[model samples]
Target: MSASTHIAVVGLGYVGLPLAMALAEHYPTIGYDLNEKRIRALRQHQDHTQEVTAEQLKNSALELTNNCQDLVRANVYIMTVPTPVDSNHTPDLSPLLTASEAIGGLLKQGDVVIYESTVYPGATEGICADTLEQASGLKLNQDFYLGYSPERINPGDKVNTLQTIVKVVAGSTSETADFINGIYQKIIPAGTHIAPSIEVAEAAKAIENTQRDINIAFMNELSMMFHEMNIDVLDVIAAASTKWNFLPFKPGLVGGHCIGVDPYYLIHQSQQHGYFPQLITTARRLNENMSSYVSERILKLMALHSKHIVKSRILILGVTFKENCPDLRNTRVVEIKDQLERYHARVDICDPWADSTDLKQEYGIELTQNPRADSYDLVILAVAHDCFKEDAYTPQNFSREDGLVFDLKGLLPKNEVNARL
Candidate 1:
């Protein structure tokens, strides 16, 4: 890894933008994305994702581009494209494949290609490597090399950032692994872990999110059971957490780009290898069903309060997949809105972090700029954004005297909400 080694980072989203920013501090880094609007926004220091601040973007020396021609000058290409699931919950490699083809055409001799996208084992070697080979007219290892270092980016997380988290890097060969590890070690102060092989690194990345999905699914199941028993799951969790080795996982809508989607990638690969992953599959099913479960709970409370189902005006406090972020990818909050709409209930969502245009474009749900006070039949705290936690944003402020309050994330006090899950 030379100081002269120019690096091109493909796909400048949540993972790529921060990473490219960090790398630019040490190397000549170029951030590339296919979306022209995204490149324009990055240049103007306006990140709709809100993962990178305007000050950081304006100060960084990193080059931002939407044209593929701008990437040919780079000596090392690191792909951070998204690996999402399709409608059938299968691994959709279109983005990864397309990125590979684009990067492949720009590959030069001795120029290494490393993938930071989450994928099943062998995807780098089997799918991406082959695509690179075909597009570049070069053979793997002989002409150029390949590497895999899965991205561990948590959106809206300020503490554990790209430089703080330990990076896992693997390559097609030992030399390639060391070269890639050395490059990442330059920016990652927390250091890098060189996996034995690319497949192990891929497997590790896939399971990291799958494990969280499974654990959260267990908590979700307990929440459902405790609901039936008229017990508070959070109380039981609090008591059990007193133990020396208890895993403290809270139950809520498990939605995001990673946990909600990664399990299906592992499930797809496992089934391809002739092994049906029952536990992983079931965990995903349970987590996916949480939105409907919450919707049912809200309707039940509405009925118990003698409120009409069809004519009720319900307000959801948040819509982003997680708190303090504008990332709406795979957010299960829409499921609740959809289910509530089935009963002809008017659903209005408000999230300070979310982009109104994105919400309207992606989910077809208009973002309510100002939610009226004391104007709802029910109020649900959906994502628990920091803005929603202030003393001014209580359930009583939004709901009428007899109106119900449902706390999905359990952020509200026990006495404040009529029900929680």
Candidate 2:
């Protein structure tokens, strides 16, 4: 870590913005994004993702740019671009590849390129390295170096930030790994774990989310099973959690950038190697189907209340993938809305954190600014955002006498809600 190290962080989204800010504290850091609007917003200290506050952005020395010409000043380029899954649930490496090629053209001798995007094992060394070599006409390790440090950003989480979380670093070689580790250790208080290889670091990050997805999927399956037996899944979890070893995973729509999407990356890589993963595949399927399951359950509850589904008004409490976050990427809540709408139910969504315009554009559903009082046949608390937990947004205030309240996250009082999943 030298004071002269000019680092460029590509892609200023949830992961990159914070990392760039942290790196700027110790080095000359440039936050680069292809989106000109995002760069303009960052210049005005307006982070729509809300990962970095206006105050933090204003006070930081991180340079914001959308142009690739500015990237030549940075010898070390850390890519924080997204590695999302395609419509077929296959690993979409377009973002990663685009960033790699862009950085390759700007590479200098002895320069380092560290990836913070979540990808399957061997992606960095295989796909990214090859792309860099071809684009730059520079041999790996001889002209430039590669590193892998998968991001662990939790959207809406104020705690466990980039500075506090342990960073795992790996590289094309031990010297490259050491260089990457040293750079991250300067800012990360929890320190860095230098992995044996880049592939191990990639595998570790992929499995971290896959494990949680599997656990949550199991809970979702249990919720379905227990619902048939007239049992509350949260209550069962609470009792089971009494055991010291019991994992306290709850049932809900498993969605978000990581837990929902990362598993498929691993599944794709595993299948590429001539082995189909049963448990991982099953977990993904179960979690993916949870939204439809919840929709059917809501319809059943409405029917039990003698309410017609065709014309019923349903108020959905949250639309974001997770609670207390404005990140609308890969949200499974849309599936619930789609399924409910298939029955011709009128679905009105409200999320204090989500952007109204973005929601409408992305999901084609208008966001209700304020949910009307005592006006719906059913209310579904899909995301447990802090705003929804307040006394002002109670379920009783939004539902009629015979209205059914379905608590997807089990945040509501058991006695207050009609049912929970």
Candidate 3:
């Protein structure tokens, strides 16, 4: 049988919003989120994540709702919630569990629930399924079914949209698998890859980001080594690019929902299966320390400029993890601010993309939306956001007469900037 006509997409953030918008082209889709404020904003064609443009939201036939009762009509429910870590760095499955419970309460017989949240293997079968069964009194693979379609949504990435990227879908049963693939194939122009089972699909999804994380971690380590040798990492990468086999992953702070966080899911699963992934764990550690490393280097740069490291005014150019995107989840840029504050350095953060209230609430770091130019002793481009990179070309007055300039992403030419990581 083909997929159902009604679909419900839970957690309307970066991932779900785009998917829901695309699916709405073919089905009567309900874009649901618990946040009423967000739903209201979406109804008025405002996307807080900025993934969906106003025109797209207004033109789409999708219904945005905050009520769980409103989703009872959807036969296909997709969960696309954020899977962040706790303060101790352990995976926090609370968001996933909460979303599952919300769906479970509205789940009807014969309904199929799919998950796009990144999790360790068995999460769909174990935690989510259990919640569904308890909430709806439905038996998995009997009264209802479950599927796993890992989200490839790159927040702030304009090139890879829902239709552009190939989606990986797997179901609890063969019939369900085909049905899910058929629905996705209609919208995702890149098509779908049906895995052998849901577990394989989950494993495949986790590794996609894990592999990138490991690759970037290698580049990050190389950046540290090159910095010690007084070599520009980006220049070395440019030289290496002449070789066909050389990977083009550059070194910078590995943040965002996927690269910085998804590896832990693989780590958790690997450990559960009685195997420790040494290389993956080591790469994660290396990437995690890069923010602090950048902070230390900037302090040393201040010392070289005949300025005292302590009690110096330093301005952080970008707070968002990636360039041109406002997403701040698991952002390592905060580490630089925290480290600078420890040394009694006045750290002023300015990111045109970041929401000042959210930054203040999450990191306890107040943001200056527009700090005056060239008013500080040091300026560190922690994030290579397009706004900051553009700011590099136009000189600022925030820095002292002979200020220390540290370009973390090597965004500017060698002669234009002082140092790079």
lDDT of 2 by residue, 39-58 (tens): 99889989999998899999
RMSD of every candidate to native, in Å, equals 1.1, 1.2, 1.6
Q: Name the candidate, 2 or 3, with the larger lDDT value.
A: 2
Model 2 misplaced regions, further than 4 Å: 1-3
Off by over 4 Å in 1: 1-3
By lDDT, is 1 or 3 better? 1
Q: On a 0 to 1 TM-score scale, where does candidate 1 land against the true structure?
A: 0.98
TM for candidate 3 is 0.96
- Taking all chains together, each candidate's TM-score versus the true structure is 0.98, 0.98, 0.96
| Model 2 accuracy (lDDT, Cα) | 0.91
Tens-digit lDDT track of model 3 for 1-421: 2244699999899999999998999999999999998989898899878998999988999998888899989999999999987766678999888878878988777899999999888888988899999988889998899989999988888898788999899999999898899889999999899999888988888899999989999998998898889888898999999999999999989988888888898898789889999999999999988888887788777777678878888888888888888888878888888888899998888888888878988889889866776677888777776655464423344566777777887776778677888
The better-scoring model by TM-score among 2 and 3 is 2
Give candidate 2's TM-score.
0.98
Alpha carbon lDDT at 382, candidate 1:
94
